[model samples]
Target chain A: MKIRESSALILPPYFFLTVFFILPVLIILILSFTHNRDWSQGITLKNYLLILDPLYLKVLIRSLIFAVLATLGSLLIGLPMAYYISFSNPKRKILLTLLVLVPFWTNFLVRIFAWFTILGRQGLINSFLLWSGIINEPLQLLHTSGAVVLGLVYGEIPFMILPIIAAMDRMDISLLEAATNLGANRFMVFKKLVLPLASPGIIAGSIFVFIPALGSFVVPDILGGRDSFMIGNTIKNQFMTVRDWSFGSSLSIILMVLVLLGVSAYLRQGRDQSMTLGEYL
Target chain B: MSHRDATSNVGFGQGKSVSIVTISGLVFLYLPIFILIVYSFNDSRFSASWNGFSFKWYKIMWHDGPLWTAIKNTLIIATANTLVSTFLGTLAALALSRHRYRFMGVYHKILHMPIVIPDVVQAVSLLMLFAFFHFTLGLVSVILAHASFSISFVALVVMAKLSNLDRRLEEAAMDLGANRFQVLTQVILPNIWPGILAGGLLAFTLSIDDFVITFFTSGVGSTTLPLKIYSMIKFGITPEINAISTVLVLFSTLAVSSIHLFDREKK
Candidate 1:
């Protein structure tokens, strides 16, 4: 009786996901192999072969580099930020964590655009530098690869910080007490005990930041110059500008595969931790 | 790495260097937003540089017809997205938390697919889907696109909340001669009310802030705020965009504060 009832409850979402999510993705998979939108030309590897061009290969490499840079930058900042909040007094911890999270609630376009107030030619940094006679010309900062990485880091750092804090919260004070009681110094306790305990969050954080950075479109489109094109820009241009639906679908498939690879790695890591870290970004 | 002994106070690495990194790290996160908000009131039209304060941009953004149309479109879509996803997600959450079934493991993995996949991938796939069916690229399509991703998130969050629920309450209610429907409606529903709200709020936010999906799914006359803002920014940065951005940032702050307050009150 209960089984039947549970089936009834699950049916709505199951049907919804089937029609909207699963079916759509599957349709695209078949569409990727075809010559045109209607598939009148039949299945072909022509679309996939087109992806082998050196130019497309270079875009993939550039995309990986950007993703790696942003992930590393986030880790460097998130670790200390997480530690400071984790170690604070209970009263202050909540407020401190809140500060780290407020930016996330904003639309990402707004967050990325905020950099304009600081990085644009007539913006804060240049204005200050020009006033002080530090440089005769305003530096070109906005339309550069560096700015894209910077935006990616600034855009997604909160995802990295929050997970590490969760891991830190899971740390038992008794473990620290036991380690110190066993003749370990403070640094030793931190290096051996705290760091190891925080590994899961660090892994989760890396996956969280890395996946989005890998597929980043807006940051590059807005902040990056022509030379800084990532795979996302290529995929978008294919569909939106080039009107090449077949190639766009194939490119989308490849990007999805790459993202799925990262997710599988994350899921493997998550086995020990389970679904606690599964909050969708 | 220097000034190590400074961590001796409270012993959680409250070192001078740690404090510097942490505080500066926070400044990195917040200072751009601080500047963005400040620039919204600037008198200058094109440059971000201050030319004293004014509300001229706010006046312009207020009267901007296209901007209002986008905002209205966003509201309609977000509301529809939230309502449908929350209902379906709440049911799925209850099913996952309260029952065991065949192929549950596979079901769980598939559920995570929408969550883990990049937005661009999801967006293009849905575009293909709608195109294949000759579906009109408009508000309905955008709502479907947003809800596809939001449903998984809503399920996950509500599932998290449902995990801690006491099954005994439902059982006891059933033992009192109540039917399964009565037990669920009277007992299980109240217990997971917060989860539903959180999931609904989350769905609303995801729909509102979404750009990639909306970018693909929306057609003429179906622009959302993010898409409108994107078109504006591409042209150039103006105090008008800054005003719109400031309002967005303010919404974020309000959301964070309310969540904080709600959490405290519940506790």
Candidate 2:
């Protein structure tokens, strides 16, 4: 009776996940290696090797450049915002926090489209400049790398802010006082006391921003000109236009590997920082 | 007294830091969005400048069929995804929290992977997986894809509530000869129902806002609102897009905030 009841409790979710989620993922993994170009060629390593080519390497570098810039931008902006909210009056904190999240509730595509109105040549910024007698022609702000980064940082700022706020809220306020009492100046207190304490939050926020930015498709596709194609756009094109599922699978596997490496490296650095700090202090 | 003194010193400089930070943060966060909203009303046909405010774009948005269809489809998918994910997610949470899970570590990690995995990769992987299995991209694929991610989020949030719950009440009920089902329904459900509701609302919002996964899994005819907006933006910008976006932003803010308001009301 006990055994029967136990199984019944676990059965539904387990069965649901296994059938719909696990099986599909496993099927994709299995098909990734099979070289069924003509449905009879069987399994091979050609797809994997194809991914290691110079062309893909360039694409991989391009994605890293975009993601890194966006992550840095989010950090520069999000850190201070998080600090404000974390240190603010408890009553007003909730309202400010809601500001970060409210934008996220709207569809991402709509938000990106909104950027079009602002950044496009005939859009607001250029028009404002033209009207102000600054320039006779509209500035070519749209369909550029800058626009791609702007869209990415805009979309991901909340993701970066939330984690940093969580970290900041948990910080030991006494440490800041200790640093100040020890004759540390304001900049010294921030650099030595607050930055170290917030490293974990920064790390977490960076991961949250970096990973998504790396694989973001819509921003790059819409805002980026032909020169701004990331690996994400490549994979998207493969399946949608090239009609090549196998090649897309290979790209997915490579992206997964790169993401894992990046995350692991980030965690390692975080771990090392804490370890060295522990040793020094 | 020592702790209080230390806290006061830290609090002293915090105000100046906060005011400076708040203004900068607001500019960083809202400048782009503000530019977009202002340009939506511009009379100028091509640029982001304030040519003049007009309701012409709003009228155009009303006449657009694709936009309406996308919104309708997104609503349907969000509703369906919420219901299905909430049911499965709540059950998963219950199983994790109420029982001593054996493979708990593995289960938790697997569920969290969707959130951690880049959406672009997941999009491609799902598309490849669907094609491999000969599953066609349509409403069904998108629904399943959304539910898969939503379940994890729902489970995580519900689990947070469950962990904070006192087990003594459930233990007492069980000790009084109540069956497990009766105890779960009468004892646990009422206490955790608020969190479950909040989780369900979040799932709905996520489903509605999702674009990347839906973009890949949705067939040509089954355009969700985000996908429709994506296609439209590639060609050109219009005022109707702005009007639709303004309405979308307002609706989502109301939807998400209401969940928090409801939660606060209980407390």
Candidate 3:
């Protein structure tokens, strides 16, 4: 309880975070404005300017598109499931929730790798179709935009489901019965009552899905072709392969700014209401 | 009444559709994982074909030196990261939850920042930081990077538990002539031990599963399971990966289920 004691408690984590986490981010932010890979050269706007080029701009746009689509895909699949789980009996509710979350426990790269096996030319779908005599040749299911989107959506679906289910669990069911009694149709009850109440979860879920999907390198890297390049891939390339630290740092800063903006909006919205990590999990 | 009939009809229809969606959603979630697990036992070297079930891949994995080394590195990093982060995080959580301070708001924001930032950004930043300091990228760097994000997770979990804790118990301990350290060790810690355990497990899970940050920070001879798996997958899919994935998935499932069951019991 003493100030000195508390400070002692806090100082270790604070120092660790400052050195490993905070300083690195600060370095990147500084590096972003510089022209040279290392800090020896003078600072310039060239990195930011380079981002404005049509090629990089297009990759950024594609990243946004993939994220938005993945968010929508997960919502479409996850919302109804969450709704069902919310209304289920307690035993069934726990079982169903666990079932939904089990895949999420698997390693992320392994899950993406599973998709490679499922969508590859000689993979599951192709094998099934070929056995059924529906096609003579294997379809090009892998290394396409669809493959990338599927990977993103599959990877992020649990994030969507968990929060939405939490929201639905907190919802007042009596309102639904009352709406039904007041002559509202099922669709009307859902649209006017349920959807509005679950909006917080939906928003939270969307943020969870969208942010990761936007910045994902693994999904695109393993599942996508050259044409499916995303901003994450470009940034990784800039740093690792090209060894252009300044450009990589610039791209990263831009992505971070965008993500922080989204997070700030979410925080502002979340301020009015209380949600717990238990529910989010 | 006709109204009753109509409502029942709607309920029946909704039930039917909900069941359909729920069943299909479960299938969608589990199908890929199930397939991957199943193929791990396939005799075929290529994962795509069913060359009859055998444990050859698993056997190969057992004898694989590099695979074992990677697993060793992963376990080492995960264990070290878990212990260090959990300790640091518990302290931070205690500080934030137990007392109000001048810089609490700023400290809270700082804690949450790492959680929100994408892994790629975090990875590159840490990588750059190491470069700046001329620190070699290796297990130590990986541990530091993982602990950075993991501390936040541990703090969040522990703080949630801390906030829900009944403060009267601590007050009673104090009133009973128990000193701060005595109350902390005997009363406070005993109560929050579950949270700390859960936080530690969660940190362990995240640390082991982490690829992006580890990928960036790992130097030669520091290939963790994920980095190793990534390289294998890039080279091409092999049943060896399937075997590895299966084991990891099973371990993770056990870890996560225990976390859930622990929390459920507490509730």
Candidate 4:
């Protein structure tokens, strides 16, 4: 009786998602294979094959590289912060976490724009360098790969930190105490106890950061120079600038497939191994 | 439990470690915001110097008509999206909670696709769909796109609250001759008001801050605040941009703090 009642409530959300979201994505998959312009022109593999050119291929590889780096950077910063917050007093925890989330709450463009003012040639960093006589010329901080990475790491760290903090909060303090009592030193305790407990959060955060980082167009567009084009920028340009919807759709499909495969592999490994590191990002 | 270390070391060492870690974490999280706020009032264009405080930017931004239009559009979209999504999501949550299905796992997973899939992909797909259907790119498309994701989030939050809800109360209402609709409105909703409010606020924030999806779905003459900011950045930096950002940040801060206070009071 309860089960029947529950399904009735679930039905609306399911129906909406199926019709609006699932249908569109599935249509995209089908569209990528069909004719470019006219739907009536029928099926063709040319769109899929078209994205395999070296130019598109290069963007794909670059995006992967950036995603990997971004995931690792966020993880490194987020994991330590999560660990620290985990051991903090409960009273201070929420307040401290808010600091992480406040930036996320603000308009995303505003935050990125703030970076331009800080990093642009005539911006703060350059002004400081010029004043201090550190160099005769202002350092070129803007429109660089470094800036792109910095922007991404700045943007995504909150996402990484929050999940890990949630996972860490769920951890039992007694486990760490037990490890310490069992002749495990601090380093050993962290390695054997804390790290394992934090793995799920870290893994989840990594996936979250990695997937979006790979597909982000804004950061690279604003911060990256000519040579810094990522796959997202390419896809965006194709649709918006190049007016090549078919090619863009194909590129997006490939990206989706790659991300799906990567996540599946991670999850498969997760199921195979008893991951202690899952809880902390 | 203190076998070796004396009383002096027990709490102090751990406390010190935690303090250092916490301080460092706060620095990581808050330093950027601190810088942003500090620069907001600077007379100098750069953040490097302690430029004299000036409100010029605020004045300029206040006068910008396009920015005002963007804000209006944003409010319209956010409010409409929040209402529709919240209503639909609450209905779905109630249905899911009160009924059982053969494909529960599959159902839940599909609903969560919007959260997991990259935003860019979703934006492109939606653009293609809407464009193909000959839908205008203005208010209608943006609301539809925003509602799609908002519903998922709202459903998830409300469903969680629903799961923890005591069904006995609803049963008692029914036993007292109340119908399903009456019990839902009078009993279930009041109990889960917090969750519903929380979800609604989230949807509002997300819709206002959405850039990529809104960018794709947004038609001509429907410029939102984020789009305005994009245009501003594309042109050049201005004090007006800072002013607008400050206002946005302030609103966000107020919203977030109120929610926190509410949660605390409940606790």
Reference contacts recovered by each candidate, as fractions? 0.64, 0.48, 0.55, 0.44
Q: What CAPRI class is candidate 1? A: medium
Q: List pairs with backbone clashes in candidate 2.
A: A122-B46, A122-B47, A122-B48, A123-B47, A123-B48, A124-B48, A124-B49
- Model 4 vs truth, CA RMSD: 3.9
For B1-267, candidate 4 gives per-residue lDDT tens digits of 223223123221134454575577566555655666667787876455667999877777778888889999999999999998998888777776676678766766666667667788888888888877888899888998998888878877888888778989988898899987798889999999988887898889889999989999999888999988998888877667777777888888887788778878998
The TM-score of candidate 3's chain A against the true chain A comes to 0.94
TM-score of chain A of each: 0.93, 0.86, 0.94, 0.88
What stretches of model 3 exceed 4 Å from their correct place?
A1-5, A38-40, A274-281, B1-14, B263-267
Worst 10 residues of 4 chain B by lDDT: B4-13
TM-score for predicted model 1 compared with the true structure: 0.95
lDDT of 3 by residue, A63-106 (tens): 99999999999998898888877666566677888777777777
Give the count of colliding residue pairs in each prediction.
0, 7, 0, 34
Measured against the true two-chain complex, the DockQ scores of the candidates, in the order shown, are 0.52, 0.44, 0.48, 0.42
For candidate 3, give the lDDT: 0.86
Off by over 4 Å in 2: A1-5, A128-136, A178-182, A262-281, B1-18, B48-51
Tens digits of lDDT, candidate 1, B106-180: 778777888878888888888988987999999999998898988888889888877677877777888899987
How close to the true structure is residue A205 of candidate 1, measured as C-alpha lDDT?
88
Candidate 2 chain B lowest-lDDT run of ten: B1-10
Candidate 3 per-residue lDDT, tens place, B30-77, comes to 888888888888898876567998989999889999989999999999
Using lDDT as the measure, what is the rank order of every candidate, best first? Answer: 3, 1, 4, 2
Number of the predicted model whose DockQ against the real structure is largest: 1
